[model samples]
Target: MTTWLITAEETVIADGAAPHRQIEIIRKVHGNKTREEALVELHKAAKSHVPDSLKGTSRVVGRDSDGSCWILPKNGKGHPPCVIRFVEQIHP
Candidate 1:
């Protein structure tokens, strides 16, 4: 199976407020799928892990040439809220 590395930066809301915390995530996804398909799956997986309140305005960011991916809020400006990187191999 091909391995896909996924990463995300999450913004935590404190007391239900704006811009609370930034959480970084890196995960390995295994499957024989195309890059587009893998991206979709990764988005689904990432969405499943975040809180429901943040679902409607979340997005994924990555560069194929650079082999990087990330998740961020839709309304964010400048850098993404979270950044992710995908790798074919996993390190211990």
Candidate 2:
């Protein structure tokens, strides 16, 4: 079986490779399925899954030209941004 893993990550700053950067694995969703089904499921989960870092406050969604997804504070309520991605894995 193949398991699709949706991983969401959060950082103290925008730069992933910044020195003294704080990184956190905020959320992950997984499902076992074929490639086509897993891709659909993982995409849906990525678009809809809320990160643990910003659960209670209001938020907005943004998409970069390079296809990065971001979650931000709706009213500048001090919530940090979150970025997510999905990956496919195979298992016996």
Candidate 3:
């Protein structure tokens, strides 16, 4: 079993200024399951729990041991994108 944490991030920009790029952790969940299972469950949780401000932004997916390892855009309709934009091996 594995534990996962998912976060929603966006490039916040001030009025008429440069974007204050940052990645904010919008949600975090822990589960006892295989990596594959955790990913599935986490995605489901993210879809339901992500805040409205992050509804159409990118997401940061990570684990307890490592920092965020994946960043992908949100589907805007309350779902993760069909394609993952980034991924890193979390286990050997």
Better of 1 and 2 by lDDT: 2
| 1-92: candidate 2 lDDT, tens digit per residue | 44556556675534465633344433343545665565455456556767766788777766655444667777876666776655654455
Candidate with top TM-score is 2
Segments in model 2 whose C-alpha atoms lie over 4 Å from true places: 12-39, 65-68, 90-92
Query: Residue 37 lDDT in model 1?
Result: 70
Worst 10 residues of 2 by lDDT: 19-28
TM-score of 2: 0.52
- Cα-based lDDT at residue 43, candidate 3: 57
By TM-score, is 2 or 3 better? 2
- Arranged by TM-score with the best first, the candidates are 2, 3, 1
lDDT of 3: 0.45
For 1-92, candidate 3 gives per-residue lDDT tens digits of 34454545555556699865454444344545565665565556544554444555675544333322333443444433222111322555
What C-alpha root-mean-square deviation, in Å, does candidate 3 show against the real structure? 8.6
Across 1-92, the per-residue lDDT of candidate 1 in tens digits comes to: 67776655555556667775554445667767677777676656555554334456655444445444445556665432554444455545
Which of candidates 2 and 3 is the stronger one according to lDDT?
Answer: 2
Per-prediction TM-score to the true structure, in the order listed: 0.40, 0.52, 0.43
